[model samples]
Target chain A: MKIKLSELFFVCVKIGALLLGGGYVIVPLLVSEFSEKRAWLSREEIIDFYAMGQCIPGIIAPNTIMLAGYKLRGKTGAFCALLGLTLAPFVAILLIASFVSLLLKSVVVNDIFWGVNVAVIILIILTVKEVWSVSIIDKLTMLFFLTAFFMCIFGISPAIIILLAVLLGTLRAKFLKGEAK
Target chain B: MTFLLLCFEFAKIGLFSFGGGYATLPFLYHMSEVYGWFSSNELSQMLAVSSITPGPVGLNVATFAGFKTAGILGSFCATMSIMLPSFFFVLLVSKMLKKFKDSPVLNSIMYTLRPVCAAMLAAVAFRLFLESVVKFNNFSDFVFNNVDFKAFLLFVILLIFSLKIKKDPLIYLAFGAIAGILLHFGHLFA
Candidate 1:
């Protein structure tokens, strides 16, 4: 299970550079690279990493890669993965910022951006459907989805909602599932 | 001092912004009001560019905002600091994850978290859709104004195609850009 830092870095760098949309889309891309192609991790492990990404505080994409890299080769692997992921966007945006003032104008650029935005939104919605079918299993999970949805819409912070879910989940495990020690 | 301040502020954002990239929008909006680093309009433009760009939306905006406030160094600091928290956090949590792998409490937490995550994803997707596709100032405006029919139609077409074909997303993205230019040119003639 010893992974070369160079390989980890390059794989993540490629993913960071080419993958568009947002964090949710990163999961499928990672699965294809690590699980299907490399056999680095199983598909279920990637899904677990996706879940762990959600539970954590910061951005999902970086966190997921960190876990993947760490699982592969400990601390160095994690740093390599993180560096690979951030390096592309940092350089890309910095380059773009130089001419952003000009780019913001030109109705042509705006039109292209508007079209790309629509496409990215569609990509996100497709991810939503894919995640939803797997995540929502029964009445209780449905209730969790509804509660989270309303709480998000009502301007509640996501941290608070996630915290509340953890508390409720722990309680359920303790009393209802009867697995508490 | 400015570099440190930028790092601190972005670190705070990275620590707090949950759900995903779009969740950071509210905090960025607040920064515009208070910090004067970037305007709301510029933030929207950054968002658009970020969406089209190859990385996470939040990180891209942080870089743009930092570059706007100071320069290239500022962009580096802001991006690094924003991601710093997650870097340390994953290290810590993943270390502990092994010991707690079989704990029922952890299992239940994840079970419940899946649905919550689903809801958060759906909410952000819907919000982005409304912002991009649906245009109306108010309820009355909705009644009086026409929806962006072309964008809506394109969305439906792409959605169906993606679901059926299951191909790479870049194809749809390129198609969208082409369609956009054609539609814009078509409008010019009319």
Candidate 2:
């Protein structure tokens, strides 16, 4: 069954437009649209795509859309989906860039933005707490958290940190299990 | 020239900002240091707009940064570069998805990534707090003279409310904007 590029693009555009918050929030919407309504992908398949989204680096929301597009057609579908996912944000940010530049000049706007800054901080702290609750589950994981924290503060590149962490984790899993066996 | 630099820089951001949108902040901060494309002050404003506007927060920041630094083409370059890695991952790794799904090694890595991501976010949160809420020459200055008490109060209230309600973050953003304006004006009047 061949799906048209336009169809894939439009589906992604809809997803991009409606997707707010971040990657995780897109799950239910994607499930309903792709798996339930269009029948383009199965529920299990959507979950697989989401899992892949998390596993991969980059924004998870559009990653899921890209996978659905690939499953629907191929590379062309993938690009189309990526484009569609990007379109809303690209436009929205551009408009915001222009608007914020002007807004920054006004004293009242400055105060408003100051408040917004506080809000952003609150949101970030909440995100840290939320991720912390789930991430800091044991001694080994706690070690990872502390080491990663110090590395970041000292300005070691995050890409390197993530790679090292993944490598250490894989090695520990392999070797520790062998010893146990 | 500039366009390509924009692409390279944002692609770097795209490649590294693991965890999620907020994770991009540290990378963007680095870019601000190296490029002089935008000031740290402007980046704070971009963060505000990114939150208020629709779309993934990281992508929105990338787009805003691109536009500020260059123009329309820069926006395209930045957005595309940031998104390119994800596309590549999907194109390449989708095939391995099924095979790796149940692999213990993969599971371990994912489990390990969770804590690392949390730590990264915590780092960003602390840095941002220092930059926005307290401007001090040193730790003692922060402890004494430099803390922005009004901003700190707003942060505490917003944090408590958000945790209690867990509503759409947009509401808080709106509240912040209004509260900021009122506070600033009230100070003038008093």
Candidate 3:
């Protein structure tokens, strides 16, 4: 059966709208969405999409959506998925604006947000752990995590840290003796 | 001039931020600190708002930051800037997927990005932690009372549970929320 572009569009939007914990959550969801639910793609294909998604730039989920779109329908599919995924949060945020006053101002609610903020903290740290397992390895890479941790916690400039990491990472990649087989 | 500059700035994030959207946090943190387009507290609030909402945290953040910077137009410029790169880059990659599918050059570039990504994420988490835990306002309270043992104790308890729990972040968030509610309303808790 030929897939309608609209169905593909909503798939991306639905995934973006209800999903939690951000990009990492998208990883497994992509596997299930394309491989299991939609049956439009295979598991290996989704992984390939993820690899490509991570390799390029921007954000991962949109990239993944683009990849999934391509898998489902080709160029038009890719852009449509991108548009759908991108628009979801943009529209959601816009709607959220009307509630911003009450959400931020209420005393009882402020108490909830205060608690929620710490939970956000833990959630972020969990995200860090999830990404760490995938990206960081070796002593040098580990050092980068430590350095960045100290600089940020101490209120050092993040641009400085990013530039330093880029420089150091480039040098390490260039100068290191061994090649991965 | 302003619209183009804002696009260029966020576009840099699109092009460079490795690991993911959170990786853009450091660059953004610096933007807030150095440029004063947005304040540190505002950025923290943006981050919290982004996390609770659905979709990519990074994109949500860029939209919030942009909106704050240049109003609706800024929001448009910033969001589009970060987005365009990935759209084009992925398109380009998809075209050449077969040619570079197994290339070592790609692997090396990705490897080099690992630490930078870590640093970016660490920057984001650390800033959030400081904003939540560190109190710059109550400086005198430190010397005179040392009464923040309550906050300290909560942190320790939360930290332990966070580490021990299986995959639930909501548990900690709920824990923090309950504690906050109790502190404010419950007389016996304090």
Candidate 4:
């Protein structure tokens, strides 16, 4: 089925609003929607967009939206999708900002905020599962995941994690050579 | 000074953040440390709202953190600074994507970053978990009336379903939301 440029505009809205967990979480949804539901793109094409999006800036979702939009309707599609995705949340955040003083003041509101906070750990786990295939090549990576988690748990700063990751990754790449990339 | 720092800082996040929005967490941690504008705990909160709400996490964070630090102008600067690179890069890349779209080097980079990025997400997630679940107000209270076992069970159950079902994340999220509501009603769990 041929998807129209205007429909791509709505795709932007669907992605921007409903797509949560941010980052790569949008990928599986894009796969289900565009590849399976809308049939806008195929499995291979989605992977390609993901690869290229990773190589570039901002967030994966927006860049993927841009690439997907451009694929369907050129620059015009890109602009509309970007607009639809960016505008609503932009306005919503502004509106919420108007209430920030009040919202931040309530203890009950804060408790709920803490309740919602519990979900983020799950979000990250799910994100890891979604983006798993590329990263965890072997037990070395398993070790990395464990080490990283423990370090983070004990209050080691993430910058240190990044530093250690870069070092370990480089070492692994040296031994693995081309496999490390 | 803070405003200018916001622009420069977000610009750095814009340029280097790869994999996805959450991939920027490590950088956010660094920024928080450098400027001391926000704590890691607050950064985690910004992240929770950023993910669930509309717009990109990076974009939401720029707006949220910016507004927190300064005000309206911080929002503008944060949003614009984080977005400017992508807005222009999108225009530039869409033109060239057709030609170099199937490159192998791009594949290699993504493949490598994928694991590192996931680890980054996991790291942030772990910290958030400790803050939410592992806090101890007092030893006696902790010994007798401690542990939010219900939350932990809900998380585990939802995690199993999500991995097993492997469907849309919205299902797991809905389960999470419902769990939150149910947990709030003390009678239900008790």
| lDDT leaderboard ranking | 2, 1, 3, 4
Worst 10 residues of 1 chain A by lDDT: A153-162
Superposition TM-score, candidate 1 onto the true structure: 0.78
- Give the C-alpha miss distance for residue B33 in model 1, angstroms: 7.9
Q: Residues A1-181, candidate 2, lDDT per residue (tens digit)?
A: 7777887788778887877654446778788888788888888888878767767788767777888888888889889988988888778888767777577788888898889888888877777887788778999899999999999877777777877888887997898689889
Q: Which candidate ranks first by lDDT, i.e. highest?
A: 2
- Backbone clashes for every candidate come to 0, 0, 0, 1
lDDT of 1 by residue, A1-181 (tens): 6778898999999889866866657888899888898999999999898778766667878888888998998889888998998888888998888987788687888888778777877766666576678778899899999988877655566656667877888888888566433
Q: How high is the lDDT of residue B57 in model 3?
A: 81
What is candidate 3's CA lDDT for residue B64?
A: 84
What candidate 1 gets wrong by more than 4 Å, as runs, is A1-15, A20-57, A71-73, A177-181, B1-44, B65-74, B140-143
Please give the lDDT score at residue B138 for candidate 2: 49
What value does the lDDT take at residue A126 in candidate 1?
68
True contacts kept of each: 0.68, 0.70, 0.53, 0.45
Compare candidates 2 and 4 on lDDT and give the better one.
Answer: 2
Against the unseen true structure, what C-alpha lDDT does each candidate score? 0.78, 0.81, 0.73, 0.68
**Chain B TM-score for the candidates in order:** 0.72, 0.88, 0.81, 0.81
Q: What ordering of candidates by TM-score runs from best to worst?
A: 2, 3, 1, 4
Model 3 lDDT tens row, B1-190: 8778789889888877766667778778777766788887777777767766777889888988888788777887888899888888777787888876776555655665665566567566665665566643344553424334455567767767778875654466567778777766764354
Better candidate by lDDT, 1 or 3: 1
